[model samples]
Target: MSMTSILLTILGIAIFVVGLLFSIAWHELGHLSTAKLFGIRVPQYMVGFGPTIWSRKKGDTEYGIKAIPAGGYIRMIGMFPPGADGRVEARSTSPWRSMIEDARSAAFEELEEGDEKRLFYTRKPWKRVIVMFAGPFMNLILAVAIFLGVAMTFGFQTQTTDVAGVQKCVISQSEKRETCKESDPVSPAQAAGLKVGDKIVAFNGQKIDEWSVLSDRIRDTIGPATITVQRDGQEKTLHAVLKKNAVLKKDSDGEVIPGKYVSAGYLGFAAQTEIVPLSFGDSVVRMGDMIENGVDSIIALPSKIPALWDAAFSDGERAADSPVGVVGAARIGGEVMNLDVPAQNQVAMMLFVLATFNLSLFLFNMLPLLPLDGGHIAGALWEALRRNVARIFKRPDPGPFDVAKLMPVAYVVAGVFICFTLLVLVADVVNPVKIS
Candidate 1:
């Protein structure tokens, strides 16, 4: 790479790293503030992991930054309840039992004389739930804010009714060839005198405003048709004979499905697209679509494991929608900065990437598994349910749910995550996915 290119790449990566750090700090702030609100003593609020680069002791909490910027945490007192004997019990010979005892011991390792009443597990179940849920909730807020900012100002690319291109001759989609044959029939669009830059206004005397609506109308017609277009500030009517031909299949949302063919009324022109600002309601609808797509990506993640493994360890191609890690995302941010577009567009694209990352963080951390925020929330809710049940039956309280006993499961989950991260790192270095 050239020196200038390298500098741009570094600048992009640096910007992304800054955004990542701020996101991490923001998420931890939610936990720290809520924990303090509920009178739970927090000892540390670190934005990253490994050796601390800087730190300051303020009141009961020590806030700091660490060397690694991948993830972060806030250390709350009494994360797990005491053993059945009403204490942090001794270590046992069994590995799982040892894991539980070690975790319980660490929860009280920084215990002071006045910390007994401020333990996290000693709070009401609802309060504990809020403390754990706040972190991921902060991420969701950040994602929504960033999305709205970009959608309302910088705008999103959308298809319009204007014509961008006109095919000279019709070609069957099943043929998968772009060359025009001498014996082939002229395209309906070209024969009807359609030209690039003409704005399609109506089809067969029916008014049309959106490209999808016009596309659907064109596909459903197969005989004589009248098209109304605005050309050079003048409205003109053009006639053509629609033909039934094999074309690419489109999904319900009007997006073309690649490599799939279906027989439909063929219109041989491509619609123009431009960045258009969206109103609040339209933006909200788009946001909902974005969130639904994110959830779908998460649900389909496990099925992509075999593909990821093959791409990382074998001579297999990496799919475009494969899961991306921090390093991969940073590289994409770099590419976005170097695009041949306006500076505002580049910045908007970068912010969108960061927003997507925050969304993923929110969704991933909310999985109901050990070592994730959702796991603790689930545990707290379960505790509340059982306690309420006991109260209803006039029985004794069940006490706090012993979450530390699941230390072995947490370890397994962490192990799997680490391995997956390593694999993604390897693939990123050797077979990186390029956005452009």
Candidate 2:
């Protein structure tokens, strides 16, 4: 790499790190602000983890930045309910019981004269749920805002009806080559005199305004068909008998899968594409697709671990869609910056990367597992359900749920996360994904 390229890479990584810190701060801000609003005492609001880089005490809350840029948190008082005896439970011989008590003790360690009423667990279940939900909600809001901003301003890359290239002859997709041989049969489009730059307006009397629509119709039509094209300010219809030929198969997402071919009706022209601005409705549809794909990707994560492990430790090729960690994302950010594109396009791509990260955070943290924001929200909701049931049955209220009792489970979850993070880091260093 050249000196300029290396320097640009460093700058991009730095920019991404800064954006990450800001996102963490934004997430914690949601927790901190909501806790304060609900009369809960927030003793600390820290972005990142490990040793503090800078801190300032204001009112009762100590705000600070930490060394690590991975994650952040807000220390809300009484996050867990007391034991059967109180926050101070009787000593238990079972290791699991001990783990539960230790968690409860830590929650109330900073007890002060007026802190009793300001405890988080003292709040109503609904309020507690809101507090826990706020952090992920903030990330969701940021993701949506960023997506909408980019979609409305920069637009999307889309294929148009204009023909970009015309094939000289039919080449089977199984051949895996774009070059045409002299012995190959003439393509239907070439035989019909379809030329480059012709804007397709209709197919078999059906109006065609979109390339996808035209592509589908062509794929389904086997025999003779009329193709209407708007060329040189005039509309003209061309006739040809479409041939059944082998073509590369595309996934549900319209992306061609490599080395996968199927026999289909063939057209012999490539559609041109441009970055076109989309309407609000179109943007919403785009977001919906992105979100659906994102969810599917997350759900399929466990299945990809073996591939990820092989890529990190062996000569296995790393799949392009493998899960990425902080290090991997930072490297991708650098790659994006070094892309040979317009400055504004680079900025738009960076924003999109950040937005996608935020969206992932929102989705991941909403899982009903301990230590994540979603876990706490689930606890509060369960508590609400129990109390409501009691009210209906004329039984004594169950009071606040003892979230601390799940400390052991949370610890296990955190350990797994840390191990996964380390594995990802190693993979990122050894066999990182490249955009090119």
Q: Candidate 2: where is the Cα deviation over 4 Å?
A: 181-183, 248-262
lDDT for position 212 in model 1: 85
lDDT of 1 by residue, 74-185 (tens): 9998999999988776758998999999999989878988999999999999999999999999999999999999999889999999999998888998998888999889
Q: Which residue pairs does candidate 2 place in steric collision?
A: 83-86
TM-score of each: 0.96, 0.95
Instruction: Give lDDT: candidate 2, residue 272.
Output: 96
In model 1, what lDDT does residue 206 have? 99
Candidate 2 residue-wise lDDT at 37: 96
**After TM-score superposition, what is the CA distance of residue 199 in candidate 2 from its true location, in Å?**
1.6
Instruction: Write model 2 residue lDDT over 1-436, tens digit each, in one string.
Output: 9998999899889988998988889898889899999999999999999999999999999999999999999998888888877636558899988888888888887889999899999999889888988998899888888998899899878999999999889998798698888899999999999999899999999999998788888889899999999999999999988999988788887767787988889979999999887888888888888888789888998898889899999998988888898898899889988999889888888888899898899889998999999899899999999999999999998888888888999999999888888888999999998775
Q: TM-score for model 2? A: 0.95
Task: Name the runs in model 1 displaced over 4 angstroms.
Answer: 174-176
